[model samples]
Target chain A: MSRIHHLPLHVEFGDCDPAGIVWFPNFFRWFDAGSRRFFVACGVPTWKELEKTTGIIGTPLVDTQARFVRPASYGDEIVVETSIPEWRTKSFVMKHRILRGEELLCECNEVRVFAQRTGADPHAIRAVPIPEDIRALCG
Target chain B: MSRIHHLPLHVEFGDCDPAGIVWFPNFFRWFDAGSRRFFVACGVPTWKELEKTTGIIGTPLVDTQARFVRPASYGDEIVVETSIPEWRTKSFVMKHRILRGEELLCECNEVRVFAQRTGADPHAIRAVPIPEDIRALCG
Candidate 1:
């Protein structure tokens, strides 16, 4: 089986546009939520905990690319599969695919960077190296 | 003045996440709205009008790449700038920048293809040539 994690999502009315279909943009929110869940499952603390514990900051998206293949309507039961395909010194890449049963809805790839939040500015935060403890649990 | 078109946007509560900042995904919706307005200003009919007239469809996105530079909060009045950089027979490209005054919020480049819908299956839609009028106006 793939190392992918599955996240089941329900489309809310608010997720729809005037066209009565799930607005294309909402997939990104769902993708973000799924990533959070995956990180927690991998034994990393929640974003809040990470911020408090390591003084490390939340990962901000540096780049994102998506392709829409199908339209999803309101109330559709969708599945989001997420995985980390690449991890580097200062950033990591996540890939997501949204599907309705057998139908593919959209696919996205996102690159996120870690930064240290100073008083008023953010400084570049490097990976240094994944500590054995964290890497064992996370990777 | 720069050829940049400034479109003021309202940040709806639904646009925010639990962190109380606008989620990154909603920026695409705002970008689409700004692009629609730009097309209207260019004397190109709105997407709905084109759909009605030539059976020409709203080109579904094939790819989008975006970077989030800053966080925006709910109720913030932000401006989005959109410009068409390439107009082709089968696809067109646009670049967008979202800003809050002088602070840059996000930047995105999107590539979309003119597609023809087939039956009720959105995925079955096939990319076709850009309608003559649209090509002429955009060219």
Candidate 2:
């Protein structure tokens, strides 16, 4: 079974727009943070450290779909529940459900790939096959 | 003819990650801004103004899908091109293409609805039908 992770966050004033609701992109940010936390809980190293140890830089998102279920305001405490439901040769699917108290605020699914820096360009990135050790760590 | 609106932005240091690439969520933020700009360019009133004239509060996203094509970094100047390609009675599709020079960074399509404050709860919201005046303004 894949491990799940939960990241709790306190929304701040800057996280909201003039509408007094949390800006939508902040949900994506929380989801991304939840994703990273999931990996860390699985004993995975930071992308910076992994780059030197395994040449695996980071998981870059290729596609994402999200739905807004409810609106959240500043000062609301939210939790992002994240899990990896599927894994492929080079990519994986991450599912995130954001909740406030008993209410589900938003949800999203992301398709991301294990990537490696290509050439010497700092910005050049390419996907690499899933490493056996990493998969085992997550499982 | 359906008009397109372009909103230009400069990537800031806070917008990037340790990897020196733009965090994906920032793209959503820019797209949201572009969505607002699209209406502004078409002479639509602000949500605050419309709240008094009509019960409509704001355009809230129901669903969104995005594809990341390229990575951008701080100091990069980018533009989000937004247009409404489809309109329904209550919701419409907002499409955005984020570009840096000739390079496409990301693209997204969002389904958003005109919303109104529901009940006395400040965060409670409900979708409203597309207003004729607003639709005409967009056109």
Candidate 3:
């Protein structure tokens, strides 16, 4: 069985829109944090540390899809459940489900790659092959 | 031909991550803004105004997918071109492309619905049929 990481968060007033519900983009922010927390829970080093050793600055998404099931509002306590369901040679899929108690709020699946700075162009980045040690640690 | 709206925005310093690239979530935020801008450009009323008359709160995403082609950073002037490619009975597909000059940064397609408050549950929302007059205005 794949390991799962749960990150708990609270919805703040600033997180909501005039509609009185959390802005949709904030869900993506929590998913990003959940992704990093998953790696940390698996004994993976910080992206900054890995950057020095492996030139891997971070896991950046190539593509992502999300389904918003239900609306959530401020003062709600939510948890992001993250897991890696698939891995490829150079990319992997990270899944995150946000829930309040037993109610699912949103779910996302992201295809991400381990990215490194490319050449001298600050905006240029290239995906590198999945690191064996990192994969092992995560598994 | 479908109407296309272009929303120009400046990437602020705080928009970039430690990697110096615009974090992916910010892309979605821009897309949402672009979606609204598209409607306004088509002479559609604001969500607040629609809510008062039609009980429609806003266009809420049911599903959204995005592909990141190139990274953008602070100081980049980006334009999000938004168009509605398809419309259904209750949902529509909104497409957005983020470009810096002639360079493509990212693209997204979202399936969204006009949402209204459901019952007495403050957090509950329900998708409503696409209003004919509103659709005509957007078209």
Per-candidate TM vs. native? 0.81, 0.95, 0.98
Top candidate on lDDT is 3
iRMS of each prediction in angstroms? Answer: 3.5, 1.2, 0.7
Error of 3 at B19 (Å): 0.4
Local error of candidate 1 at A95, Å?
1.1
Error of 1 at A2 (Å): 8.4
Writing each residue's lDDT as its tens digit, candidate 3 over B1-139 gives 6789999999999998989899899999999999988988888899899888988889989999999999998999999999999999999999999999999999999999999987656587899999999889888
Q: Model 1 off-target regions past 4 Å?
A: A12-14, A18-20, A120-134, B1-3, B10-20, B74-77, B120-124
**Model 1: lDDT of residue B132:** 75
Instruction: Tell me the tens digit of each residue's lDDT in model 1 across B5-76.
Output: 679888888887644567677888888887777767667876567657655456667778888777777778
- RMSD of candidates 1 onward, in order: 3.6, 1.4, 1.0
* Highest TM-score against the true fold, candidate: 3
lDDT of 1 by residue, A60-124 (tens): 67788888777777778999999888877667788899999998989999987654445442222
Ranking by lDDT: 3, 2, 1
Candidate 1 is graded, for docking, as acceptable
Model 2 misplacement above 4 A: none
Report per-candidate DockQ: 0.48, 0.75, 0.87
Can you tell me the DockQ of model 2?
A: 0.75
Candidate 1 iRMS, in Å? 3.5
